[model samples]
Target: MHIEIFITTNYYIGCFFIYFFMLYYCYYFYNMNRKSKRILVYGIVLLCVFGMVVVYKKNSTLPLVILNAVRFYFAGNPTEDVGYAPVSSKDFTVSVLASGLTAPTRIALTPDGEYMIVTQLTGEVFVFSRKNGVWNNKSRLAGKIDTSVLGFPPEELGLVGAVFSSDYADTGNIFFLYTYKNSEGEIENRVSVVSLKERFGTLVFSADPEVIFTANVPGNFSHQITDGIGVSIEGKSHLLFLIGEGFDAKRAQDLTLEGGKVMVIQADGSNPLGVRPYPSFPKLQAVGIRNAYTLAQNQYDARKRVLIGDTGPDIHDRIIYAPFF
Candidate 1:
């Protein structure tokens, strides 16, 4: 019904404009003629009504009719090609290194594409390096990682998302967002920046990661969620962090604990250099989200928005438009 209305509206508007132009032309051809003027005006009005009827008929959909048409259309057709040429499945065998890992939630690729990082549901960030056109695991960023201050409940936790510095090919800086313990020994969601060390030209994971910004947000492990990490292209200090509510729906509105917010901050884990801080607490971008899973900037538009695939109770999966900074 909606499609029919839409198509009808567009078709009528188009036909009306065309009819009006023809009426004006007839007026030009027969100026001050009463019959010609009546014909012109009546003809155009009749065309409009007829157009609506025709468009309604053309756009209307009947389930049974459509099903029969589809069945007949494909009944004797042997050609697989309809519009696009088909490609044989055996023609390509592209394989990724971390396909066997369970619940590889997020992936990060270096600026040079030489290395890739995969975060897992088990709280481990697995590093994959491209060597001789093939990828291999280099290291796993896990173990000895504090969870209490980083904001996760005393349940099983693992790495969620990671990002290499836009200048990592030159600066070797990388950051990871996960659940960890705070200063008071409480689990929380937070982001941390760590400098990757190049030992003999190989990247190695570090345990003594630099605490850039440990969010003081309070929440249980199941309530805190940070899904994706990406450095802002505008400034090295500016970083985009995706905040969300975990599978547990009861804690979506907890703002003090960074439950559903996009926290943006510096590389050293501080607010913008000269900007006055918010009264609520640390620096943050737009808040109020369900579960933001992906953060990306449009290459052509330079607009930034988080791709939130929220877990809902029998609701449609939505892709929300989170405005750019």
Candidate 2:
């Protein structure tokens, strides 16, 4: 709860527009006309009396920091300006708990929230079960190490990233950041941690997998390691990942090279909580990044912030706000 971390990059990402600038000013007063709907109904009656004085001052982190800024919105900017509003809020409701399931990507929950640890791009790892609230039973974490995404650039690389192990529901263990081949075979990039269970109902991997770090790059297949998201702060669990400069991108502005940045460690399997200076990354927290494809953490704020959606090389896609001290 003593989270303070800071570092910025706001070409108008001005710290994530202070949480969607009031939902893009309520999406410009929902296409105003009737005197801007009475000034958007007096700004929703002064935001329902300023959210009942911020929920009677309990301020549960300002409504989970606007629901983690609408679950860290991911679409829109198909060249903004044609009524740029990518946040709709009917008090939120977006469904589809399960589907054809393949090439999934990322989603981890279990910090005792029942379960929901999906990840795929041809490396698989599913596990639903939200008790009765919809998420269903879709198990699937079968074993196999030395696994590589193998999905090849079809929408970009495989096994992008995965996390879980801040006591993964009593230590089912998890963590991986694809693309292997080490021991001098070249194809670098790995981040193990394995160990899982639940046999009969499906969910294997109770052995090999503890290589927690690696990097050699030149694998050149797309920014490779994209997420790890597991932060603890006071309890000390840390694992915030991202590394995709494999295509060289000027060696991610060279900080003794580890490509891109945001790579921390010690996610409950201790070691290396050191060195970080230059463009930093010997456990660095932030640095000239790109391809920040996925990372959105708020942890009920106290500024535990970790939102980094930075992707640029054309059309500046900023939103880098790492916080933790």
Candidate 3:
């Protein structure tokens, strides 16, 4: 549907440009002097020659040549295409680990590296493992979360992120972030934890999930439910979360709200870490963020520096870094 709309719109735009230019040429041809007319005739002849070359060869060189000529006229230099060099066959190889997935968003592996958990954007989780020297897909629904109830498109409101616990091998705990519609018919984002277990020789999750956090957001704003989730690495007791501003930039600076901030809390959702000079919201790590699309903790840095990719408002994108104490 989107592709059809795009092609139709561009087709109309191309028609408009062609007709408008034709009318302009007809009007100017009668009013221009002899020298101007000669120049216009030469330009039209050159364009016809270029079009014939493009139509006959069906190659990209004509467009590139035209673009290079324009660059030379404006910047006094034309771009050169350096040919590719030959390389040995052993330089690269490809392997397929898994297949037949529906819009897979995130993949989390068990601490022991024996099992892999894959999450789908359509609200499903699959577990993959190796058996008898071959990887097998043994996926099952993790819970009974109804994605249809979200009352919005899957791109806007659906399962967005997932992560495994650091002690997943022993505890079998997993976390997820998704969007849902509340009782008031308002869209909301939620983060929850659930335990995975083997029942009747098949891996499955508990029927219920322990809800950790949720935020009410406007239903029409799709960017409200951005990707960010808590991850435990190297037996770290603290879990890190990056929340977006929900299209409300002012809420980012407000300490009362969780939007547009880095939050750190214990694994059990207790004992929120306090930011210096602001102990009121212990979970608040940093604020004044517009839209943190990506978050990472530096493994090599001794200070446990947290890096954030913030989507700015009409100006520029920014990468922010701060200590994750």
Indicate the TM-score of model 2: 0.30
Those runs of model 2 whose alpha carbons end farther than 4 Å from true positions after fitting are 1-44, 47-49, 52-173, 176-194, 197-202, 205-240, 243-261, 264-268, 272-282, 285-291, 294-315, 318-325
- The TM-score leader among the candidates is 3
The per-model lDDT (C-alpha) reads: 0.59, 0.63, 0.63
Candidates sorted by TM-score, best first: 3, 1, 2
In candidate 2, the residue pairs with backbone N, CA or C atoms under 3 Å apart (3 or more residues apart, or in different chains) clash, namely 5-323, 5-324
- Using all chains and alpha carbons, the TM-scores for the candidates as numbered come to 0.58, 0.30, 0.62
Q: How far is candidate 1 from the true structure (C-alpha RMSD, Å)?
A: 20.0
Instruction: Indicate whether candidate 1 or candidate 2 has the larger TM-score.
Output: 1
Consecutive 10-residue window with the lowest summed lDDT within model 2: 2-11
The residue ranges of model 3 lying beyond 4 angstroms of the native Cα positions read 1-92, 131-134, 137-140, 147-154, 198-203, 216-220, 225-236, 271-277
For candidate 3, the 10 contiguous residues with the lowest summed lDDT are 146-155
- Please report the TM-score between candidate 1 and the true structure: 0.58
Q: Write the per-residue lDDT of candidate 3 for residues 1-325, one digit (tens) a residue.
A: 8766665565556556555656768998989999988887776666555454433354223344455446656764222563444465488544466667666767776666656777776777777765565566546555644454532222345666676665666777777766676676565666677888866534578657776767533432344444544545344545566677766787788898877767656567664543343588776767787766567768799986778888876789988887655
- The digit string of per-residue lDDT tens for model 2 on 37-85 reads 7876676566555554444344333444444445545543333664333
